[model samples]
Target: MTMEQICIRLVKVDMLSPVRALNRFPSVIRCCASARTDLMRTNSSSSLKSRGSVTAAASSLCLRSRSGLNTCITAFRPPAERVPLIIQPTREFHTSGRLRALPAPLIWMVLKPLQKLIAIILGRSIRKWWLALPPNKKQLFREWTWRRRWHFVGAGAGLLFFVSLFLLTHLDESPVTGRTRLLVFSRENFMELAQVTAEAYMEEFKDSLIAPSDPRHQVVEQAVRILAERNQDIAEISSVPWTVHVVDGPTINAFVLPNGNVFIFTGMLEAVADIHQLVFILGHEMAHALIGHAAEQASLSHVVELLSLILLTAIWAICPRDSLAVLGQWIQGKLVQFLFDRPFSRKLEAEADQVGLQLAAKACADVRAGPVFWQQMEIYDQLRGEPTIPEWLSTHPSHQNRVRQLDRLVPEALELRASCDCPALPKADPRVIFHQAVKLLLDNAKKQENIAQEKKNEKERAGVILPFPQSPPVLTQGSQPQRGGVLATSALPQTLLSK
Candidate 1:
C-alpha cells in the first residue's frame, strides 16, 4: 500500500481501538509484520483485502501489553476477525528509564528525632545564656544618656522635614468615602492605584472572599464595629472613613490599611472561639490603623530605600567603574530588603501588639482571651513544623513572647475592663458557648445534606445519568479534603462552611 493509504488504515485501526490513541508516534518503530500475513488466511475472499490490511497494521504497530507480550493480530484486532496471530520476541520498550522511589517515611524517621533532640539541647543552652546575663542590663541601658540630646535633636529635625514635605503634597478627599488624607499623590491617582490593586487581589483570591451576607462576615463586622467604638483611639479615627471586609480564606490572618480598610480572613473567625476573642484580634488590627501604623511602616520603608540609594551613590562615586557600581547597587538593594526593612517591621509589629492589648481591654472585651489565643496560635505553629527564627523574626513579635507579655498585662487590662460599662463586655461561659457552637454545626451540616440531596434528585428527575463515586469518601475528625489530598482536620475550621 502507498504511505498515505497505510496512514489512513492506521488511523481507522486506532479509532476502532477501545483505548486512547497516541498523539504522535515515537521516532523509532519496531514490530513483526511477517507473522500477521500467516494469520490472515481464515478471512473470506470478499473481506480478505480489508482484513489482511488490518492484520498487517496491527502487526506493524509497536504496542506492548502489561504481561510483557507484544500485540498479536487476533488479540489486538476487532472481534469480527477470527484470524489467529503469532507473537515474536522484541527488545523491551524504554522511554526515559525507570526512576527509583525514595523511602520518605524512613528518611523522616531518621531526621525528625535527631532534629527534635538538637532543638531541645540548643533551646536549653540559649535559655542558660539568657539567664546568665546580668539582671541590671535594662537598668544599665536606661541609665546611658550621652546620646539622648542628639537623638531628640535628630528626631525633631527629621519630623519637621517630613511635615514640611507632607504639607507640600496634594491633599484630597477619597472617592469611595470622602475622607481627607495626606498623600504625595492626588486622590484620583491614589484611587486609580488602589482600585487596580484591589481588583487584582480580589480576582486572584475571589474564591477566598466570603459572601457579604455570610454569618462569618457578619461576625467579623460586628467584632470590628464593637472594637472600633470602644477604642480610646476613636477620636483619632473619627475623621477617617472606615470599612471592614471579610476575606473567605482558611488561613488565620487579618490586616488593616492606612486608609481604615480592614480585611479579616474566615480562618481567624474559626480560630477565635468567641466574640471577645474575635474582638481582641480585631482590636489589634484596628490599633494598627488608628495609630497610623501602615503609614509609619511605609515611611520607614521609604527611608530604608533612600539610605540604600545613598549608599549605592557613595560606592559608585568611590569606585567609578560600571561593574563595581552595579555590584554595590545589588548588595545595597538586598541589604535594605533583608536587614533594614525586615527588622524595622518586626519592631512595629511588637508596638502594635502592645498598643492593641490596651485598646481591647479599654473596649471591655475579655483580656484573658488575648493570651489564650496566642497559646492556641503556638499550637498551630508547632503542628506546621515551621522554622522558629523566621516566625520570630517576622513583622510581629514571637507568639510565645506576645503571650507572656499579655499574661503580665492582665491586671492592667482588668482594671481598664472594670472602668468600661459597654453592655457587650459580659463574659460567656466556655461550656455554654461550645454547646451552642455544636448545635450550630449540626444545623449547618443538615442544611448541606439537604442541598446535596436536592441536587441529586433534580438530576434523577431529568433522567440524567449521575456518576457515583467508585470509593466511599473518607471522613476523618478534623480533616478536610484539599485540592489534591486530605489534610489533617485539626487545621480545618470547627465551624460549618458558610453558605
Candidate 2:
C-alpha cells in the first residue's frame, strides 16, 4: 500500500469517537502490522527472506494484545523511519511523563490543615455543648438577643476588656530614658524585622555602597567605637555589636536599625563640619535604637489601625452613599495622623535629642556642638531653598525647635561631661563663635544698606557700586572680648544664643 493510502486509513480511524476508536483499535493495529512488514520486505531482500521471523513477530503481537492492551502497544515500537498509526486508548491513557513535584510552603501547608482541624473540632464541640444546654436557657438566650440586644452590649464590653488587658501587659519602659510606651512587638521580633528591613536597604543601595576599605568607613567605625566605649553605662549601647555601612548617595541622612545596623550617606558626612558633630549625629541615631522606638511606633500604629477599622465600619454602615463613606475614612485618617501620629513622633525626636546630647558629652565630644549642628542644618535647609514644613504636619520637630531644646540641655550635658571626667571643654564655645559670625554678617549687611542709600541720594550716581565685605570677621581669643564689647553679647550661660 502507498503512504497516501495508509494516511487516509489512519485519518478515518482517528475521526471516529473514542469508544468506536477503541473497539476498532485491534483491527487498525493488524493493518499497521501488515503495512510495516510490506515496507520492510520492499526495502531489503534479506528481511523478506526471513518469513518465519516476520510470522513469529506478528504472532507474538497478537498473543500479547490478548494479555493486556497497554503491554501490547508499548511492546511494539515502530522504526524511526516509519510513522506510527492506530494510537491505543489504553497506551495513551497509561503513558505519562515524569511530573516534577514543586516544593510547597511548609508554614502554609501545616497551617491550613491544622486550622481546618481546629475549626472542625471547635464547631463540633460548640454544637454538642449547645445541644446539651437546657431548653429553658436556650429560650432565654434567644429572647434576650431579640428584645434587649444583650449580645451587642456583651461583645462591646468583652472587646474593651481585652484591649485594656492587652495594652497593660505590653506597656514597656525605656531602659535608658525611663519613658513608658506600648510595645506589643517583642524585642526579638523587632530585631528580625529590622534585619529584613536592613537587607532591603542594602539591596536597594548595593550599587552605591562604599567599600569597607574607604577612609569614610574607617572614620565612622572609629567614631562609633569611641561612643560605644565611653557610654558603656548604657546597657543598650554596650550590649549589641554595631555594624556600619556607608552609602554613597546624596541624601543627607543617617539611621540605625534596632538590630544595631547603622546606615550613613555621604551627603550627611559632607554636611557635618567636624568629628564632634558626627559623633553627636551617630549618638542621636543610636538613641532611637536604644529606646526601641521602632517597636513602640509599630504598636501605636497597630492600635491606630484597629481603631480606624472600627471607625471605618461605622462610617460605611451609617453613610448612605459609598462616596461619603470613603470621604469620612479619609478625614479620619488625616485627623489621626495630625493629632496622634506626628505629635508622638516629635515627642520621640525631642527625647532622642536630649539623650543623644548626654551620650556625646560622655564620649568627651564637644557638647556645645550639638545645638550648633542643628543651627547649621536649619541654615543649610534655607540655603537650599527648601520649604519649611509646619511642625504640626511633620514627623520630626523643626530644626529651630531642636536647636532651642538642645540649648536648654547644654548646661546639663556639660555637667555630665564634667562628671565623666572628660577633657575640659575649650573656653571658646562653638555657640559663641556661631553667634558672633551671625552678628558680623548682620553688621556688614547694615553697612551695605547705608552705602546703597547714600548712592541713591547722589545727584549723579556713580555707576560703580561697592560690594559687601567678602571676608567674615575672625574672632580670635583676644578679639572675642572686643567683639562682645561691640555686640554687647556676653558668652555667659544665659546669653547662649539659640538658633
Candidate 3:
C-alpha cells in the first residue's frame, strides 16, 4: 500500500477516538514501516516514481489534525520542502472555524504558567543580587532606605487619604438615628443579596415553617402590622415590603432580612412573657431592616477584606521567611476582627436596640417592654447555665449592657410616645411585674420542695411501716348494704320476693 493509503487508514483509526487512536498508534507505525520496506524492494528500479508518489502522499496528509499531524507528517519529508499548517491547534485551543480567537492579552495567562514563572525568576534574581552585595554595601543600602523612609511614609499617607475620601463619599445616614455609616451597596443591591439568604432559610426550614393560617404566623403578622402601621417615622416601614414567616422551632430568636422579611421562631413566642415583649422583639428586628444594617455591615466587611488583603500581600512580599508571613497574617486577622469587625457589630446591635425602642414607643406597645425584655433575657441566660461570652468577643452587646442602654433611652422613648398621641402607659412597670412573677414561681417551687422534705422527715421519724389496705369485695348492683357495711344480695325480704 502507498503512504496515502496508510495515512487514510490512520485517519479512520483516529476518528474512532483520541484514546483508541493513541493505543493503535504503534501498530500503525509498524505497518507503515513494513509497507515502506516492501515498496522500496519492489520499486527499487523506479526510484523517481516512488519519490514522487511519496511526496504527493505526504502533502495529502498535511493539516490532518492541524499542527500536531502536520508536524508528524512533515518528519517523512525533507525539511526544505515541508509546508507549515495554517491552522495550528497548538497556537489556539479552539478548533471551530466560526468562533473568534481568544483575546491576545489573555493568551499568555491562559496558555502559560506566567505568574509562577515570573515569581520564580524574580525570587532567584533578588537572591542572587542580595548575595552578590558586600556587607558594607548592604549596610549602606539599609541606611539609604532608612533615609528615604519618609518617602514611603508619605506614599502610605497619600493612599490613606484617598481611602478616607472614598469612604466619606460612600458614607450614608442610617434611618431614624441619622448615624452616618459606610454603605457601599445600594438598597436594591443589598435587597437582592438578602433575597438569596431568605431563600436559603426558606429551603432550610421548609418542613419546619408555620403556615399562614397557623396562630404563630398570625401573631407575627399582627405584631409586624402594628409596628408598620402605627410607626410611620421609620422610613423603611412604608417604603419596603414586609413579610412574616414563623419557624416552628425552639430557637428563641427573631431576625429581619434587608428586604423586610421577618422570621420569628415559635421558641421566641414561648420566650416572651407577653404580647408587649413580643412587640418589642419585633420592633428590634424591624429596626435592623430599617437602618439597613446588613448592607452597612457588608460594606464594612468588604473594606476590611480589602485592607486585610493589602496588608497580607505586603507581609508576604517583605517578610524573609514564609513562616513569618503566615504568623503576621494570623495576627493581622485577629487584630482586624477585634478592632473593627466585632466592635462594629456591637455598635450596630446597640443602635438597633435604641431605634427598636423608639419604634415600639411610636406603636404604643409599652416602651418599658424594651428594658424588661432584655432583663428577662438576662435572667433566662443565667437560669440556663450557659456560659456567657465576654462582650468584646461577642458580636452582640451583653444583655446587661443592652438593658442599661434601653433604660437610658426609655425617657426619650416615652416622650416620643406621648407626642405620637399614644395612650398613657400604665403605672405598673412590666420589669417589676416580670421580676415579681419569676420570684413568685421560684418561691412556690421552693415551698413545694420544703413540704416534700418535711413529709419525708416525719415518715423517717415515725420508724413504723403501714400495712397495705384490703380492697372492698365486689358486689352485684341489686345487693343492699347491711349494718356491717357488707353487701347482702341473697337475703331479701319475703314481701319483696312475693311481689
Question: Which model scores highest in TM-score?
Answer: 2
Compared with the true structure, what per-residue lDDT tens digits does model 1 show for residues 45-159? 2122222233433533334434443433232454675434443334455598777443333333356546534543444454455456686974565566554878878988997
The predictions' CA RMSDs to the true structure, in order, are: 28.1, 15.6, 19.6
Worst 10 residues of 2 by lDDT: 480-489
* lDDT against true structure, model 2: 0.69
> Please, what is the TM-score per model?
0.46, 0.63, 0.62
Query: Highest lDDT among the candidates is held by which one?
Result: 2
Kindly report which residue stretches of model 2 are placed more than 4 angstroms away from their true locations once superposed.
1-146, 149-151, 456-499
Tens digit per residue, CA lDDT, model 2, 1-499: 7653563355344433433443556555545455554434343422222222322333222111222333222124345543333333443235679873422222233455464345434444555566777999999878877886787889899999999998899888887778788987777677766776788998999999999987788778777887788888888888889999999887889999988899999878777766778888999999999888877777787677666655655665555555776687679879999988999999989988988888888888888988888887776676555788899999999998999899999998999888887666679999999989878876876777677566655624656555533322232212211111101212212211110
Error of 3 at 161 (Å): 2.2
In model 1, what is the error at residue 476, expressed in angstroms? Answer: 15
Candidate 3 lDDT by residue in tens digits, 1-499? 7664674455444542333453457555444433444434444333211322345434211222433322122224445663332111222254666754443223432534454344435544565577778999999999999999999999999999999999989988877877878887777776666776788899999999989987667766877887888876556888878999989896878999878888988878777766667778888898888888877887787777766665665666566766776687688879999999999999999998888888877777778877877776676666555688899999999999998898899989889888877766679988788679768866776666677667667776798544432222211122221111001122322311221
Candidate 3 local Cα displacement, residue 56, angstroms: 63
> Candidate 1: what lDDT?
0.55
Q: Candidate 1: deviation at residue 139, Å?
A: 54
